[model samples]
Target: MTTTHISPEFTALLQSCGLKHVAIIMDGNRRWAKQKLLPGLVGHKKGVDALRTLVRFGSDHGLQALTVFAFSTENWQRSTEEVGYLMRLFVEALSLELAELHRNNVQIRFIGELSGLPEDLRKLIQSAHTTTATNTGLNLQIATNYGGRQEITQAMQALGNDIAAGKLKPEDITEALIQSKLYTQDLPDLDLLIRTGGESRLSNYLLWQSAYAEFYVTETLWPDFSPAAFEKAVQSFAQRERRYGQ
Candidate 1:
């Protein structure tokens, strides 16, 4: 995929604002397809294309990390057929795009309950992560079957086990400890969170990491979220006064 160009001044502004990590709720794939009277799967495919562009955008613009809400745990509530299609799409997309992403120096990882997915999908996800483990360009985290609440609960459970094993005391548990147990422990806290398709809610995505993230929402659907739109988001973020609760 070709990288999209943004003005150097805009890139400088992003760097000046200390934009390093970004998270996105890629919403409205189905809605985008509906609007075009196409199958929902088509919308998802287009969304994947937009994601490719996003990865390139982040790499080209020097973003340290980019996390996207790809498939949420709650998404299982959708029709069985749709869920199945999404699973297949994941397999297909990863198979097709993993090489290019690795060549671009993007480290790919899938967060969430990996045990619940099909065995084949799990293997593919693992392969993708391993293949790009050494890449140093962009840390790309794809949240599959993930939920913020569930992540916290699991972290607490792990902490409890450690305490039971005498590895840690309850008093040793801090926010930092909990954060370390999260899927994003190695990455920086979210600098910006963008939700496409006009959504205003977090919708169970990176709840802890987003505590101080500047949010940018646009009516543009996920499939149409272009690099220019992302630049606009950064521009919006640049104007904000992030006191971090002062």
Candidate 2:
């Protein structure tokens, strides 16, 4: 597996493109832990740390928004104990990071269903979103219990309901309207998507919004995905000449 690297030419290109947004699938945490003989929860913990580091990277690089696939709706199939640990970890993250996030002007938003989450967790997420809503810094989005299919389905259902209520016409349903209904309604579409862990598949991520995104895959795993590694992904993205099916 070839490791990615940054070059001056690539840096010029990324600067030219003006990095607006970046989305990532924080993959390979479980594999990282299994290789180290560490508990699965330890991997998740490190994954969070990686996320924090990447968030700061995005900030320093002038990116406006970042989205991460933190937990998928399908992830519920994991053992209950692990799932429970993740929920508690999430709460801890909120408690510890919300202030720092606010201090940095990073607005937080959680995509996907929150109704099924623990009442306290749901409250914590809501408070974070509300408190940071006015921030103009990086719009950090975390997808928890999120599935692209479900996101699309829910957006369609919302449109259908609006149409049935004499609020919209079939012809009024434009691409922009549908996009506005997505979890990332106000966020820019993904410009680059980085997935680590050697997984070539999307594994149920942001399919609709990433139609034209540049993909950079690696086997480094999330825990070891350092800032230099992330910069390398950006460098790869900058080297690409996107034609968008032209």
Candidate No. with top lDDT: 1
Q: Tell me the tens digit of each residue's lDDT in model 1 across 109-188.
A: 99999899988999999999899999998999999999999999999999999999999999999999999999999998
Candidate 1 deviant stretches above 4 angstroms:
none
Determine the C-alpha RMSD for candidate 2 after optimal superposition of all C-alphas: 3.9
What's the number of clashes in each of the models? Answer: 0, 0
**lDDT of all the models against the reference?**
0.92, 0.85
TM-scores, one per candidate: 0.97, 0.93
